[model samples]
Target: MRVEQGFQPTPYTEGNPFTTDPVLPNLLKRLLPRDVHEEVYGDLERFGLKVLTTLHDLTSKTSEPRVVQYDQWGRRIDDLQTSEGWRGLKAQMQEEGVIGIPFERKYGEFSRVYGFMKQFIAIGDSDVISCPFAMTDGTSRVLELVGSPAVKRDIFPRLTSRDPSLAFTAGQWMTERPGGSDVSQTETIARPVSNASSPYGPVYRIDGFKWFSSATDSDIAVALARTGPPESGSRGLSLFLIPLRRPLIRPVDAPRPPALTNNIKIHRLKNKFGTKILPTAELSLEGAEGYLLGEVNQGVKFITPVLNITRIHSALTSVGSIRKCLAIATAYSSVRAISGGRQLLKDNVLHVAELARAHLTYRALTHFVFGVVLLLGKTECKVATDDEVLRLRLLTPAVKAFAADKASGVMEECMTMLGGQGYMEESRIGTVLKDAMVEKIWEGTTTVLSLDMVRAAAKPGVLHASASTISNMHQWANTIVSSCPADLVHRLAERLATLRICVTEVISAYTNPSTPLLSRPTLALFAYTTSALYLLEHAIWAHESGEATANTDIEVFRRWIDEGGLLPALQDVRRVKTAGADRTKMDAEIVYGNTSTTQVVDDLPISARL
Candidate 1:
């Protein structure tokens, strides 16, 4: 709502105060389930051992520096050398729709690497553009439908079947010539063939040139095409499960022609700013034969499932990039001595405080992201109920918007702390910073997410108890502000107070059905503001508690709460809540034309009553 040219994106984080709630703690613990960790770690290890190792041999061994990830202008990678398979992957990621890493053919021999590739498909996309994780998750659901036990058996067919030469990867759908972000204007057309010889009676023929396709040379593509006429918009669009080897089904006996079937051809790749290894491509599909995956005119809907996961991955990618930045910033502050004789962070106690706080801020977001993933696991391909559907729609924007905002600040602060060296090539935060700059713009910009937040805000009582639980959270923050050192806490209290104002007003605004729809945007901002402070304030509360201060990245929860000038700043949030409640009561009174009620119970925000 307020833009400041002087604005510096700093993460003034705080701890959560609601650990007392058995449900939250249990949920959080479960959210970062040990099983999930084992799975993730397992996937990463297998990926490297199987896919990435082979990938290194294929690309760099083949002598392609361009595929190794260069600067926006073809300059050079600063430091923190690129990861395995990252270079070649980046080359095709920005332009081509699909890519295959660790290309090999064990066909029926080696299942280890082949087994790993499928997992890589799920996770590699996690850090992708537009949050490919969400897209994958969505696709995984469809896979379950089309990709059932029967299909998995038909495709992979063996658990230990490792084919060093058998390759499968997650292909990306990036370029939309009508415009990348503007999917409604797509010119790609998929027409059902008449009297076709394929098993499905007829194959849908696709014709269109895609620009900026990423993740090239892979098993399959989650492609978008217009099944109807051009003017039909998103509704006319449909999703097709276009496999690399067409004519050949059941995933065995490796086809001779591995090239993308029919009319698919690669154009030039674009050299861009960051995300280098992703492999940007310009592709032409002339009468490409593809199977229609979902209902006609509802392709976007089918893709929406994976799109959700993709957004979260995109958020996590930003998180990872920022993690790299924080590493440099803290390091620089620790080593670089400043005017006060000690390092910049030590020169002023305040600086040390901020440094610790930023560290925690990152951890807090990361933990929350993992929590979202757990939630995603529970969510299915199709939202069977309205509440579930609404939750997905609302949560998607919040994840994207909030993650991007924090990413920019995290990078900026990390760079600022680094000072001179930060600007240099060696610091490396600059690369992460520049890499992150585009995140907020692509995959639904910050402002775009804010609007989505507003839309989510319109759904009152969805969370049921989320708002109240969050409110109780503010009270915990108030305790920290009350107990912490005098001067700093006072300033923090003021900001907290405003945060409270923003929160309560939002809860009241949305809960009060009598309130007009025109005011929802402001209401939505209040909701987002609440979500921000809820985490921040809770972080502060956790630090003050000390008994269960997070030990590792989990400790970020503790570190954030200790950050200077944020504890008391959260006090304002409570005030906002109070005002919001009052506003709600007032609106109800006016709507019913009665001045008698002191509190509006039935119409209260879902979180309140719950």
Candidate 2:
């Protein structure tokens, strides 16, 4: 008898993300001017091929970076060494103008859309290069808004440069030992340097320890330091531009400044759960020289733009990771067989359903992020109306939180579809999953973001403005759904009504101090409703435009509105209203685990409780 080899699954071959993504091309076509769309489409196709080939290979071969704390002679040299692959990726990112596109503003209000679309496609394989690029973009925006003219002339060009040698990436250093997200607890101090100034701003000597600093290898950073009394909280803080290495001396021709001459000491690099290839470190800034970006004691206000931009980047990262994982699972399913090799996994209805569900989620998130991006672009171009500005403020945090919360589950679903192959590092899905998990925590945890959304909603006229926008979306969607089956139209109308009721109830609770507010759930309800509206609007556009994927788009919209758990969430609003005390008691029991004293203490209103 002859021995036969066992079966082997075919290797996964990834398609060009820009061209192969089911939703993006159509989305761009619908949103962009025809000529602009055509131009970007061609460019994206070529870039997409590079992403699948060059970028993919670079990220695959890249090793985690390491910090060499000392040299052979016991010299304290904090040399951050990264792989050749990492360097190549960075070079490509600059050469491709990944961070410069929006700043270049070749397309006016659509520039951000164009830039972010490229970012969304490239992020999956960029080896967390997006991390530094995001900070660079945010830093550039801050300088654009408030930097001294000298700073812009000297530093801004480098930030947006397409020439790899001329380009500069920036880090954001805000977290300290006393605070992660709470800048109020920041302990860094900046003491002014009299009769000293640089092209950047008024010079200061900063002395503090930054507990967590990502993009540690970047050329420069925007850091927050206390310039006021210790008791002043966040209002006492000030923003500064800190060059990571010492600047060259004033002479026209001079040797380079000695390493770490600025007194930035890299205490240690973090061993993180994900984004391993990116360099992150704790730093002691002992008399590190920095330049103030804006007015003193206004760091929080000046840093808002950076936070908003970075949060948007985080949302894109989350959605992009999910898209990449789904792509891998999808390609694998086509080659992998099931039922004793009688059928491919792609042919299995249950597997296909799971894939479809994940795709639906990806599609919804893409729309949400891009919608916010469009608003940002408008704001940047100075074309955003007051209402548009308000809508952007309300939606930014909600969308960021929503996308991040959905990403992990979608990643898990894709991984499961690939079985054991997905669990392996070789698949790259595991790596994406790991890196994507950081999105939730870095920008802000879901709970923190939910509270932010609640705060935004509570702002005068913000809630009403958002409700008005949603109502407008409903009217447009109703017109589109009118021609469909009565039941489908009825369902759409009912959901809209529920959304209105939820918004009304939230406003009522806000107005009436006696009513308990469920901040997290309210965010969920609004985010889900907004996502559904955006998806429906897209479906209508696709159908009206006679796009090839109109039917599929309509199906996605239907499944999202009907089976996406929005109805259950709506129903739960009633239960929450009636069962607040009971729910509170149960929550305390679950957390304290039958400890009566703890439960009683926890159940008390926050004003009366610890």
Candidate 3:
């Protein structure tokens, strides 16, 4: 007797990300001017559909790039071959003005909001094309701020062009064998070429090996090289714009073959664990012609704009990855069955609780990243107040580090929500998990970014200004919570007090160097406190405005304040403070395991020993 086949799970289908997203529409409506929101609303909807359809299809069909080192004739002709689908995505991004919207400034201060909202929707499925777009966006900003007239006139237009054929993506070649994030150890050398003449700037011959060059297929690049004594460190480095390909020299009617600029050689594409579709490579620059970007030995100073912009991009990507994973899990849960097909996954209380908790964190981070994006737009438009600028400075690194640090865990939880299918690459959730993992290490590792946060807060008046902003947010939230349930009101008061105490400790640590503070914990405390306040602010607004999701927003805020989010950071701070003289030894023991002669708790489980 043949038995009927078991049930087949329904296929997961994604909707237009922008339209289907529960939080983004309300966010834009609240943050953007009515006219601006109305103007871009249709475009966002159409682009969202395109992202799931055309963009997704294109990326799904493509494979990672491959390199050919030589021609059949044994001549040294390095050829990089990417799939047609990859090229199609690049063209689509250019046509959509993914990098051009902010440069156009059509919406003024809200342009970045509009631009990055599109980026947030598209990045998850862009097949890592956003990697090139980030560097390209940063390059355009650099050019606008410091490029010479000739350079801006020649290249800036291409960088920000909406026309696919005219657009030029840029590579940021900063990493070398000797230095990764530590630009101080950069060994690439740049020498002035007196005989050469260029309209861009004074030409220089750059010589070095770039160990990791993302967007290797780009038209031009900004590289950092030393011009001063080797020991001068970062102070000796200068920024240069290097044309990646030689200008075509076509005689009267003859066709000349294309070539790499100077002696630039494509060594090989990196076999990375994620973002495989992007062309990251090791490059050899033997006397490559480059143009000076700013004053000599000011590379570190000039590249600050690029670093800031890219860090924001990293934060956006981190949050976007989580959103995509959550979307997948949410969509899949409706159809996936459990308990011998008697119940759907979404109806299961335990499963729904995990998704709800993940959603809470996602909501908080969404506000945190977009808050910085809005500040960036205002600052770029020269309309930001002094306090806003200070807040931006302090929050940029915190957002990047915090969002990246949290995204992986949230994504892993989402993956688990999908059960065994989540572990398969076919689900795309696993792929996103791998890609999101890179954001933590991309712009800067959590440790490095935490230190950067400390440096920013250490600046004169920065900590005070930032704390003032959070305090104001807390005051507003304090008033709003008064109308809520008494328990929520109590929780809000307690959390606000904790926030104040955390801020005091942070200020004391930065102001009085004698106060010991771990950079990672300090950054975490700052990020969580600020994020908690932002979530509360959003909840207040939703409640006051009578938004449809007001109940959910209030609940998220409630959970976040009540031992859901800020507890980890508070606990970390307490652990550090109470450790006192034993902090160093305890940290070492935690990392390396206790190597002392202390009696082993063999009777207890391994987990209890810690």
Model 2: per-residue lDDT, tens digit, 1-610?
3345565568978888988889889999988899889888998899999999899889877898888888899998888888998889998989888889999999988989988888889877888899999999999999999999987887888899998777778999999877789999999999999989687789999999999889887878999999999899999999999988766223335443433788998888899999999989999999999999899999999999999999999999999998899889889888998898899988999889889889988988999899889989999999997767877888899888989899999999998888988898888888899999999899789888877876776665665335445432333334534544554456466654554565555554333423244666666777777777678778777776778988888788777777776677666555565665667778878887778786799989999985
lDDT of each: 0.50, 0.83, 0.83
Q: For residue 509, what is the lDDT in candidate 1?
A: 47
Write model 3 residue lDDT over 1-610, tens digit each, in one string.
3354665568888878999987899888878988889989999999999999899899787788998888899988878888998899999999989899999999988999999999999867877788899999999999999999987787898989988767789989898887788988998999999999888888999999999999888888998998999999999999999888777222324432333546789988999889888889999999999999989999988888888999999999999998899999999989888898889989999999888889888889998899899999999999997767877888899999999999999999988887788999988888888877889899899899877877887665676435335432233334544545554456466665665665666665554443245678878877887787677767767777888988788777768767555777767766666557776788788898886634556656778976
Regions of candidate 3 where Cα sits further than 4 Å from its true position: 1-6, 248-259, 465-491, 513-517, 589-610
Which candidate model has the greater TM-score, 1 or 3? 3
Instruction: Output the TM-score of candidate 2.
Output: 0.91
Off by over 4 Å in 1: 1-138, 146-167, 172-175, 197-202, 245-260, 335-350, 381-389, 454-501, 507-610
What is the TM-score of each predicted model, taking all chains together?
0.62, 0.91, 0.91
- Stretches off by above 4 angstroms in model 2 are 1-5, 248-259, 465-517, 594-610
Looking at model 1, residue 327 earns an lDDT score of: 53
Across residues 1-610, which tens digit of lDDT does each residue of candidate 1 receive?
4576653333222112122211233324333345543443443444434332443243332211133334578843211223444544433332222212111222221122222223323222222332332243345445545543543543322211233233334454635866767788888888988767444323688888787655444445667888888888887898776665555343456543433445566655557676554445676777888767657888777776555656766666666666656655654555555664534455568777676667655655555454444344335423234443554455566666666777777677777776666687545566556656666766677565655555665554443236334333234334434554454345456554655565455455444534333243443353345344445534444444453642332233333444422344344333443454467676777888664333576568879888
